[model samples]
Target: MRKFQNRSKLSQYLSEQRTKVSSIGFVPTMGALHIGHLSLVSKALSENDFVVVSVFVNPTQFDNKDDLVKYPRTLEKDIRLLKTLSENRIAVYAPTVEDIYENKVVSKSFSFNGLEHQMEGAFRDGHFDGVGTIVKRLFEIVKPDTAYFGEKDFQQLQIIKKLVELYHLPVKVIGCPIHRAEDGLALSSRNTRLTEAHREVAPFIYKTLNTAKVMFGTKSAQKVTAWVEKQFKKQPLLKVEYFIIADIETLKPVKRKSTKKSYRAFIAVYAGDIRLIDNIALN
Candidate 1:
């Protein structure tokens, strides 16, 4: 696989590839690749003529400095894993922090149709703004025909869809399904941070979500949420941040079960010090 750490080199190369009429599929990631990440890569590989995977931990997106500091950096290992996934057919654009932001003189403000005030946006202050900025920058840099993102970050997927419309970008943003482990815990890089004991019980989060999904068919929204909270409260290791049964479209918490629209159970849990988020669809 060809690896380019310089933005100019990568952009110029991708531009050249464009002249050849390459249908480039882009997978932008904050490093520490896991099964979930490779699943998105697999989707990109299956559909596009050429695939470019970016492994940069964007500093601007972090709401907490400590979390940023604690975030793992296994670049060498990550590249090795990527190599194993695709037999040197994939290209890696692992740019340094300086390369991506050296040109930005000022922070540009973004309005994601009020998407910035809910869930992750509400909790992690200017997180999506940073996400919007970096993704917008990468889209410009890569100039791919299509971009792939995991539905694991469901809200972020929606924001990017809006971002493309707002900017009138030509690239198609595809949201792939969330990949989980056999035990049902959604695969995450942060899973590495879970204590040995916590890791064993981490599957509780998904189990509860599964139960909540089944109950949603028979129970009211408020009662379902209450039950989810109570279930989480039973486990000392798994601390629930926010649990809600919300409409899939607006992402606003639905107080009552709706027979018309689809609903999703979204939850973020603090398993030891690792923060994990997962969602499941409910009709």
Candidate 2:
């Protein structure tokens, strides 16, 4: 596998590659590689002639400075993990902050059409703006025919779709399925920070979501939400931040189930100092 730290060299290489390949697939990640990230890369490899996976922990996206500092960076291990997938077709771009942000590190203000103000955006101030900025920059630098993103960050997925629509970028944004642990905990880089005790109870988050999904049609959205909160309240190790059943398109909380529109159950929980978020589709 080819490794690139400089954006210009990578761009020049991709330019040379474009003439020979039918399609180039891109998977932008913040490193701390796991099965979840590998799944996205695997999908990208299957679809495109060449795949570019970026591993840069973007500073602009974190609202809490501590979270940014604590975020995992396993570059050498990440490259080794990537190599296990493919040696020739995959190029790993592990750029320095200076390489990605140049001089100033700031996010570009983007109008996500109220999609940004929903769940994650409501909590993390300017989080989506950071997400938009880095994603846009990476999209510009990579300029792949298609980009793959995991659906664990459903809101971000939708916003990126809007980002592409807003900018009219030629790249196709594809949302891959969420990868989870055998115990049902949604795979996240933050999962690395979970203490042994916290890890034990982490699967409860998904268990509660699955139970709530069964209660969707029989119980009101409000009741289901309250029940979810109560379920977490009983667990001392876990704390419910927000649990909302909302329409998939608009992302606004729905009071009643609508046959006309699709909905998903979105939940954010605080497991000790680490925060975990997961969602399930409620049809």
Taking every candidate in turn, the Cα RMSD to the unseen true structure, in Å, is 1.5, 0.7
TM-scores, all candidates, are 0.96, 0.99
User: Once superposed on the true structure, which residue ranges of model 1 sit more than 4 Å away at CA?
Assistant: 103-107
For candidate 1, the lDDT comes to 0.87
lDDT of 1 by residue, 1-283 (tens): 7899998899888877777755899999998999889888888988887889999888888888889899998888888888877865588999987888886633457898787677887788788888998899999988888999988788889899999999999899999998999999998888999899999999999999999989988889898988989888889989988887778778888976667898888888998778999999988
What's model 2's lDDT at 74? 93
Clashing pairs in 1: none
With candidate 2 superimposed using the best TM-score fit, by how many Å does residue 119's alpha carbon deviate from the native?
0.5
In TM-score terms, candidate 2 sits at: 0.99
Model 2, poorest ten-residue lDDT window? 250-259
In angstroms, the error of model 2 at 35 is 0.3
